[model samples]
Target: MAASKKTLEQRGFHIEVLNLINPLESMSYNLLQLIKDAYKQGDTATAQTLCNTLSYSLYYNPNVKDPFWNNSAMSLCNALILAVIDKCIEEKTEDKICMYTVANMLSELGSKEIVIDKQGNTKNVLDIYFEILPADSVAKMQYATSNFAKGGTTRGGIFSTTMSKLSIFTFEGIAKMTSRNSINLKRIGFGKSIQGKGTPRVRVQIIFPDGSKESIKTDTEGRFELNFKQKVKKGQRIHVMESETKKKMIVEVQTINKDTGETTYKVVEKQDGLQIENIVIFEKPIAVFMIVPDYDSSNHVIASIFIRQLYFVLSKYAGLARGGKCHREVVFLLDEFGNMPPIDDMGNIVTVCLGRNIRFNLIVQALPQLKMKYGDASTTIQDNCGNQIYIQSGNKETAKEISEKLGNQTINSLSRSGKGLSIDKSKTEGIDTKPLLTPTELMRFQEGESAVIRFMKRRDNKFEKIEPFPILNRGKTVMKYRWEYLGDDFDTDQSILDIDIRSLHEYVNPRDLIIDFFPKQEEESFEQPEESNVFVSEPKPVPIPSEEDPEEPQFADIDEDIEIPEEAYASEPVSVYESEPASPFEPLTLENWKHKTAEEFFETHRSIWNIIEKQCMRQWNKSLADIQASTMETFIDELKILVTTGEIDKNIYRLINGKYGEVMDSLLEKEGVKEEV
Candidate 1:
């Protein structure tokens, strides 16, 4: 029942001309029948109208072959059809009327005003003119060549301008506007050039957008100025006219338009202003000088450390001071000393950082490497900063080499005579340096003690404390140790005469008290416990066998009193004493107390224990015995066990010992024990 109802609904919908098959066939048949009827009646207007209407429908209907065609097609068809009809009318009216109408339209178009819409379609009076202009060949060429000439005409006259006049005005306006925008007003200044000793002269002018001009003459000082003015607007011109040459120069100016988001700039160049005279260029490139010593055989580690330190130092100083944009301070640490590779890492730093206005100083113990490294030691230190100092090296060989290379003052003996700190003022040549001594603070230096100090006053070169600068261990030189091990022995006051204490020139391995002294103290047993007494006295008697009878008769034997010397007689009564004491008293002697009981001994022990406890508390708030025992066992025993068992790396252990060795030594010494190796 549902299917039947749906089918009936479909049939109802089909009732609306669903039987109209083949739309094109139907249309063609209908059109032919209409034409036939019109022809049969001989109604020409009806036939024509019917044919036009049919053609129009064919062009418009989307279902037809030329569907979707709009006004362009309609207008084209109308134009052609109108032309055909006009031709027919001309034929009928003798063609004179057509020619007259065309001529009149052309004349009207030339005088009309015109406006073009956004789509390039002309509006206003010009749109009307376009309706009559002839589309023939002869009229177009003649009119196009000379639009403003007599008898000229156009499709749009209201907004259309004369071709010749338009071309001239557009070109002039564009050129003038471009020139005005390109001038840099802020950088503009007037100056003159001088040839020989004669007074310099140049002409200057300022041209404004309103065609007004101002002129100025440079005086003997060769300077002239155009006072500051309000910013010129876009399209405004600034022309500089030379009074001497009567030449004109266009200045460029630029303006930004926020409304239209456009930048209008005028660009112009003059060949005369391009010829600038009296420009000077310096003859030298900016350079920096650095120094490293030949005796510095430490493989450049020290040099690297020093250079890195100096880099940061100079960077910080440069940051604080101004007007040093072109100035640099170069430090030569490693390969810069002498005849080595020029492009070494050390030299690279100098090349990279130094430029003109830069000041530099280099240090090297010997001239050999410098001659070897730099290819020319004589000229190595020669530059804007020609100053060099020959410091006392480790030996005479080193010192002599440097002195000869620098050609500076040579003091014979730096160590023996201690004339190491000498200055040569005459050797400076073009360079200037005062006898600037190293600051007392910096020169109070020991060997290996060096610092690149910027003398407060000196500008050309830096001052460096030279090596054997005395690693002063009691004012004597220490045998130079391996550079790698130098750091390990640092601060040990190793008898190295002048090694620098302040420098991180070499790796310092921390001193280990355990390795050097712990064992020695242990072997000596430096701390021994003091003897103590914790005992009390007690009365006691010895048993002996009876000599006379089983029951020994104990009697006090009476004896007659004998006269005694007065010297022996006492002031009081002298009583007879028995073997055992009558009173409760004992002799205070080890011999007499040898028979003391266990209880007495225990009381003595308690007394001594209390005294020890109180004394320990008074000092360390801990039992001395306990503290000493615990610290020794934990640090030595546990550490030794861990080390022996391979649980702890020796370096780590050594590091700890190095750091706390002094603390450990002091503690043991306080406990009456000298530190042992």
Candidate 2:
């Protein structure tokens, strides 16, 4: 018996044995009391021996009739144990846990017996199977079984019987199939009650799980429905409240069962009490409308998540449409569209959604912003749009393109041009064509102006032809309706128009809305320390320098006759002063200097003459004296060097004219320079 129990444990049959033995132990309370008494009397050895004896007896002999006990308990246990051992071996061989092994375990534990109402037929034992099987496998199984049950082929029938014996178990499946009739009835009841309405005489009240109630009135046709934006849990009640009139009705609704694919509804009538209705079950693509501001950055990431989810839903609907199962259209109105992450398979959807009755209304700030976010894909998306409307745009490129699309128009042109003396004028008028609205005109359009471009689809042609037109005040009248609804009351101190616009720094606080996903850097405060009240004696003032102090002079006195070297005069006279070669170098009279050019006058100055002479000798192997001797020509040569070297500036001539008027007059006279030509 000990060896057999060990073998059972090794084969995983110990659980079954424990299940059977646990009941026996509870029933044998007197034996347990005797063992406890022995242990309490300080005879632990005897108590342990008694416990061992009880364990041995339970393991060796399970109390039941011969073959019945062996087959139902021992044999079943052995089979289960062997199956587990085989599964473990299979797991080791595969290097992973086989899903079938888990299914087999559930089959053994969760199997149920179903009695077929046929004489001489054996009872069907169905093993509950797991639902982790591939979708194709489940589909194939469902198809084959459904076909076979209708008395098809022998092999198919056998397969069907086998499938019936093992069900792919899901709680939702039972609810979906068994409660279809009830759901249909509820759908009918709700449909009838709401069929005709004008502000429903009856009020429908919905009582949610949290004990909160919402009341709603039916429309003119008596049709009313409530759409819950938030999640609804199971067991929530929805019923119609009492009304004053005899037309009072009660409505009872079941909470929606998402898993079972059930929708909740309620129906009520004056004669009939509140009746809970089961909503019709069918698959339709869910419509989503998202509005996001283009300027909002804080919620961009969150909005991206919504866009991705929307794409996923659309993709699923597309699949359904392909299978000919989709019955309704799915439309997405995405505003500020360019700010979100790229939608997966956007190109494919743009091409395919039209056929599938799925529409995407993408509202973007500008085409460029869209192109920036989606790259070349933006062009493909734009091409797919059947109609495009362009509102007044600050963007020049967009406005220009829009204007050009409006096309050209013919007009008359006239030209006339001549001068007074010639008087040779001819008037010519001819017909010419030009753009109806130029780019500049489009750019200067008012705020409410717009242009429209539409692509008209032809059945015979694969490509669409674009037609463009201009629209003035593109829906500005809608604002009047909005004002009518909101009321125009601007007489308030806190009116938005009265507020002054300032820089972001004035309104934005650094501490507010700080998103700290990671550790933040600490910043030192810039507040200054307070000044001390204690006074200190002032230091003695420094004395200003006086003539008596005798410091070096900052400005030296100029001499009346500063000696300039004779080498400063040129050896050969330059052409500018060649006509007056005998011109005196000093004490120049107005007659001799009057003809001198401004350049000659500049070169005669001491500071400018020295700079020019040095540079000429360095660069051209020519000095002021070598170029011209005792003539205004030498000054002219030096002036050329100064101008060529960019050493003579306008300011130098102005200074010379201001401080050395007489010297300038003498040089001007030598070169025959005059105040005016």
Candidate 3:
């Protein structure tokens, strides 16, 4: 379980269990636990509840305790689940869970490249779900349900998580057959001969319905049985091939009902084999050790499914026609029973499952808590309980009920009347009815005091009833976890431990999902605000001189303008500043600049116009005058903005800076727009 690892690990038990199957992928394991298993046991109600597990994506009213309140909504969700799963299995695109495996597969952008944003982030399956599904759209799956639902949904998220984490319904060894000695292992072997290629022991592979393959070996006689990691069905194709050479002995079949359908492959005649039966390998069912977290609210939601299904499968097998009752008695010790998710047919399980040899001991703090989760069904559960135990009663309601159930007994009392009135005396015995114990008396029960009420006894079908008895305040001994009380086999609570189960978020390998748009080349450079000039994508940044030094920083103040003829740039253009010498394009002439608009100036002159635009949007109110390059890079920013905003003519500061080697200008100089000293 994702939760409860810490608590279990604290007791020197670190369990890292993840059966998470991506919902977008076809389940390789049994699907019966979710649907068919229940129907087999004639539990249609539970079968439908299991169906609700797949309805995680659907909207549910937080107020609705009953998930089936909106039958149409539930049906729509179930249909989607079945549809997606069917498609995923049908497509079997690497049998991987992804957008493409389901209804909203993202198409590969040319060559195998997946589209990414400027941040290099790509969309996943969850992204598409959120993009199309707006919870508030056809909403009010809210007020329609009871307020017992968690977070405006009837445990939908947990339902999704449970579906994701399923592999074999109830752990590997937990599922049992309907009959004690029932098994149908259909083993199919390749047509490999004892004298075939190499040794007959050489392995052959079987490709599953999903594109994944597994190598299965042939016996000494070139005989082998059919075994599959995934559940096999009638029509699904299974490919047989040689193991080492990666050769398939498969071919297209002519007859498969539809003549126009995609060509289906069959094992080559040499690879085909006969199926042999009656070779059985039975494994004893093992115990399930599940640890759930008490802290998280969703723990109950997750755990409830496991408990419910475990009971369903176990009880179903026990009640089978060929199965003997009480062959394997399964006992459930459920702690904090009231907090667990409300299980379907829990009342029926408690009363009816006794014959199936399954038992459940639900421990809760109070009767009201159980009633809160189970609602009206609590009465059935409580009434059917064979023996109810109370170690100590603090709950007023539970104690009152216990006191009432104890009933009253008639008590005989003798009274003697004697007085100085005529020396006469009389003694009489009378009986009166009084409760064995009052609610107040039971509510004050002390530590170790307890009572057990056995309601009825049933030998086979006949029932024997018992009269109500007093609520006894008998002493009970509790097993302590102290070192003195525990043996060497047990661990004490002196030291605590933990194991973190959450792994790194990075999961998908980009290589599996993408091909590089372009082959490897020189790394591209970006012009960050403080790193390089905005005009160029790659250029030396203007440096600010420290006040302590007072010396000019490189390229901070250019004393002379450097000029070059138009012919010099006719070949490969070079940067005006030598520190970074690669000019992407030639600067426009003065006449061209005068005609260019602000947008044109910024767009043509700057590679990072967007960054400049952002800065300019904020600088409108700030004073751009008298700010020198020595103060900060803003001084250069002001020069660029002045020309771009058309506040001054001819970009006077750029010419004075001598970086662009601009021709001298006088009109702008008259406006006192010269470089700051």
Best-performing candidate as measured by lDDT? 3
Candidate 1 minimal-lDDT segment of 10 residues: 509-518
Q: lDDT tens string, model 1, 564-599?
A: 232211122211123434533332232322343312
Q: For model 2, how does the per-residue alpha-carbon lDDT over 365-463 read when each residue is reduced to its tens digit? A: 667766666556677788887767766567777667666766778899998778867879878899999986787876776655666666533332545
lDDT (0 to 1) per candidate: 0.31, 0.38, 0.41
By lDDT, highest first, what's the ranking?
A: 3, 2, 1
Question: Lowest-lDDT window of 10 residues in candidate 3?
Answer: 184-193
For model 2, the stretches where C-alpha displacement exceeds 4 angstroms are 1-299, 322-326, 417-425, 431-433, 457-470, 474-481, 485-677
Output the better candidate (1/2) by lDDT.
Answer: 2
Q: Report the lDDT of model 3 for residue 346.
A: 79
Number of the top TM-score candidate: 3
Better of 1 and 2 by TM-score: 2
Q: RMSD of model 3, in Å? A: 19.8
Report RMSD (Å) for each prediction in the order shown: 57.6, 46.7, 19.8
